[model samples]
Target: MNIVLFEPEIPYNTGNIGRTCVATNTKLHLIEPLGFSLDQKEIKRAGLDYWPKLNYEVYKSFDDFMEKNNHPKVWMATTKAHKVYSDVTYGSDDYIMFGPESRGIPEEILVDHEEECVRIPMFEDTRSINLCNSAAIVLFEALRQNHFEGLNLSGELHKLHWND
Candidate 1:
């Protein structure tokens, strides 16, 4: 799976997303004009020791990203969509894109790909969910639909065994 961030402005969110991507073995694509430098301490601090292992690339633009990645199968997450994310069948290599913290993916782009857009169900009064949380929610659903391939499904306690 892949996670693409369009013009991400928050380093902490990006950092935390990066850590999640690393843990999930997912690739991350970042579009440029980023609000914070990749070298920022905040990003590193949030990513902790996992940033080094993260597979990520920065793109000059969305067009550059599409052209370079050969136009991957992407699902855009936005508040303006009819379908729920889990309704769509996700391939293992599918890309899930989220927009900037403040604005979100451009309306023009969303209009062009309306069929591929998805939204989490939320109350009409609220604005939107947090970026990192939304990503995890949709991603985990995708992972679950695919039976969480190559991921650990269980764990052991440090000093106790469940079978004891």
Candidate 2:
């Protein structure tokens, strides 16, 4: 599975998400107009030397990202959606998109692709979860549903764990 961040605003969050992607062996794509430079020291500090270990790519624009991957289906995570994320059938090639910290995806994009949206259930009055946390939660669920057997594994035996 791949994680696509659309115009992410905070470098620290991006760094955390990058590290999570690395740990899960997921490819991370960052769409541009980023708030900070990739070489920014804060980003590196937040990532804590795990940046080099992560598989990531930076796209100049969303269109450029779409042109390359061009997956037939994309699942956008939004609070406006009624469908819970766990209800969807996530495929291995399906790209999961998340928006920025402050503002979600642009209305034009969201409206154009309303059918593809999914949301995590939350209590009333809660705004939203952290971007990195949400990504990790959903991505791991997708991986779990797929059995997560073929994912990268180091030459070491480790105990298996699952969340919920």
Q: What's the lDDT for candidate 1?
A: 0.94
Question: Ten residues in a row with the worst lDDT in model 1?
Answer: 155-164
Q: Tens digit of lDDT per residue, candidate 2, span 1-164?
A: 88999999999999998888877778898999899999888778878889989888889987898887764577899998768899988998778999999988777888878888889899998999999889988998899888885776458777777772
| Model 1 Cα lDDT, one tens digit per residue, 1-164 | 99999999999999999999999999999999899999999999989999999999999999999999999889999999999988999988899999999999999989988998999999878889999999999888888888999999999878867797
What TM-score fits each model? 0.95, 0.88
After superposing candidate 1 on the true structure, give the runs of residues whose Cα lies further than 4 Å from its correct spot. Answer: 159-164
Among these predictions, the greatest TM-score belongs to: 1
Could you tell me which 10 consecutive residues in candidate 2 have the lowest summed lDDT?
A: 149-158
Error of 2 at 150 (Å): 2.9
Residue 164's lDDT within candidate 2 is: 29
TM-score of structure candidate 1: 0.95
What do the candidate models score in CA lDDT, each in turn?
A: 0.94, 0.86
